[model samples]
Target: MKKLSYLFIALFSLSLMTTSCREQKSTGEKVEEAVEDTGDAIEDAADDVSDEVEDAVDDNK
Candidate 1:
């Protein structure tokens, strides 16, 4: 029983190590995510600027 418990613990630890190692994003994936985030930020900024411009034009009336 004791040997079985040790074997189980070793297998569990090995699995945890392997799964954690693979969970990290590859460099290419990381770069893609960064580009997507930047795109989202730019889009949000454009929307904000557009709203501001509309408000300014309305104020001119």
Candidate 2:
């Protein structure tokens, strides 16, 4: 029947939408974690550079 086809189509669209939404959420989480890792790396590098500068200054004193 025509009504049954419409119902099936609606259900299929809804399922697809839910799957896509879940995928987006997972991707967003991965991106956030990557950004955090990058920030940590940058901070570590900065700390290393600062330590080197301090050592050089101490040597001059």
Candidate 3:
């Protein structure tokens, strides 16, 4: 009975560890997606600024 109990405890601990690892991986993916979205936004803003500058220069000409 004691051996069975130890086995059960060990299995439960292993299950928890696996679940925690999966959660960490999910969190990492979310962070990577956020960074990609932020990078895209920055790129868009830069493009808009460049377009505005080009328009101003054309107006001066």
Candidate 4:
């Protein structure tokens, strides 16, 4: 019974270690992420500008 308990504990520790050692993002992945974020920011800014333009047009009328 004690041997089995030790084996279980060792296995649990090993699994925890492996789970924490996740694969890091490569350079290409990082660049892709940055580009995606920039795209989202640009889209948001464009939406804000469109809204402002509509508001100004309504005011002029």
Winning candidate number (lDDT): 4
Score candidate 3 by lDDT.
0.92
Candidate 4: tens digits of C-alpha lDDT, residues 1-61: 9999999999999998888657999999999999999999999999999999999999999
Model 1, range 37-58, lDDT digits (tens) per residue? 9999999999999999999999
Estimate the overall C-alpha local distance difference test score of candidate 4: 0.97
The positional error of residue 30 in candidate 2, measured at the CA in angstroms, is 0.6
Q: Tell me the tens digit of each residue's lDDT in model 3 across 1-61.
A: 9999999999999998887443345888899999999999999999999999999999999
Kindly report which residue stretches of model 2 are placed more than 4 angstroms away from their true locations once superposed.
1-25
How badly does each model clash, as a count of residue pairs?
Answer: 0, 0, 0, 0
**Per-prediction TM-score, please?**
0.65, 0.58, 0.59, 0.65
The predicted structure with the larger lDDT, 1 or 2, is 1
lDDT of 2 by residue, 1-61 (tens): 9999999999999998887443345888899999999999999999999999999999999
- In angstroms, give how far residue 6 of model 3 lies from its true place: 45
